[model samples]
Target: MTIKRVGILGAGKVGIVLAGLALKAGYEVRISGSGSVDKIDLTISTLVPGAIASENAEVVANSDIIILAIPLSRYKNIDPTLLKGKLVIDAMNYWWETDGIREEVLDPTLTSSEQVQNYFKDSTIVKTFNHMGYHNLQEEALPKGDPKRKALFVTGDNHAAVDEVTKFVDSMGFDQVVHYKLTDGIMTEPGSPLFGASLKYQELKQIIDNFDHTDFGRKISSTLN
Candidate 1:
């Protein structure tokens, strides 16, 4: 689907940073929090100047693409029906220190995005915007053609959806790496050398190659087995 408007499902740091990127990229942006507009308006105004503040349902219903920047624990609050057939970006990470570890997150058989995709059912769930810290997002992005431009990876089960998000990422000033499936996205999770490091294309690929021959691959192999 052609994505004209973007809806961000959290009003926190990550949500606002992404909203700023989308706004800078010329997309109609709407951001929501658990509270009413009156509660989130100031945050959005100060952080993501052009973004509109709305309730979760309204943001989800009106946008062409939805971004889930809320904590993974709050996934249930998002109505699957509203996300049906939409391109949804899963920008959440499971932090044991904050979001108590859960069985699903630790399940060897499932990638984090896979679990999130299961919940969103028919939505095209693309895993992205999760690896880096929110503070590093805006300033770290180098223009697309810069030789030392940082690269971001995009992974999802749907090729079309992944391609769409790659375009968005490109517009946001990062080079895009496309993984064949959601499971491959684990390379971008915490602990991997590429997780938050601002590396150019070649350096990022080398790290992935190195990671594969080490203990990281053994753990992943066991999980996928």
Candidate 2:
């Protein structure tokens, strides 16, 4: 899909930051929190000047790409019917402190993105943005050719869907998109060193290369490899 408009499902730090990036990259953005649109109207106006604050369904309806920035525990609350055939960006991590220790998402055999992909069966799910924190997202963006530009990783099952997200990442100023299979998403979860890494392409590339030898990586090799 040619993503012209981006919709975000959460209005928290990650959602707001993503909205700003999408706006900077010349895409129309609509963001929604769980609460009413009235609650985040001012927040979106002040934080992301061009983005609109809309209800969840409205955001989903008007957007070309839907970003799931909500808490991991609340993902099931989203209605999958609205997302049928849409590209869904799963930028959510199953953080225990925030999600209150859910067992369903703790499965080692499958990545969280796998679970999200399963839930939104009809939507093409790509995992990106979740590995980095909101602060890093705000501070790290650099012009496309700038040598200091940070690296971003993209993981998904569908090649075309992933290609679109890779373009989105580069447009947002992160050059050199590192592509991985959707199953390898487990290597970028919270417990993995890659999760919060804010490095250049080559720097992160080294870590990804040696991932199979790491203690944590070895623990999950049977499934991820």
Say which candidate scores most in lDDT: 2
Per-residue lDDT of 15-134 in model 2, one digit per residue for the tens?
Answer: 999999889889999999989989999989999999999998899899999999999989988887878988998889888778875565445566678878888899999988988888
Inter-residue clash pairs, candidate 1: none
| Per-residue alpha-carbon lDDT of candidate 1 for residues 1-225, written as tens digits (9 for 90 to 100) | 677899999988889899998898889999998788999999898878889999988898899899999987778777789788889989987666656755644455676778888888988899887877776787777677898687777788898889999888888778876775887677777655566777677776676667656747346535433
Worst 10 residues of 2 by lDDT: 216-225
Candidate RMSDs in order: 2.5, 2.6
Find the candidate with the highest TM-score and give its number: 2
* Clashes within 3 Å, all models in order: 0, 0
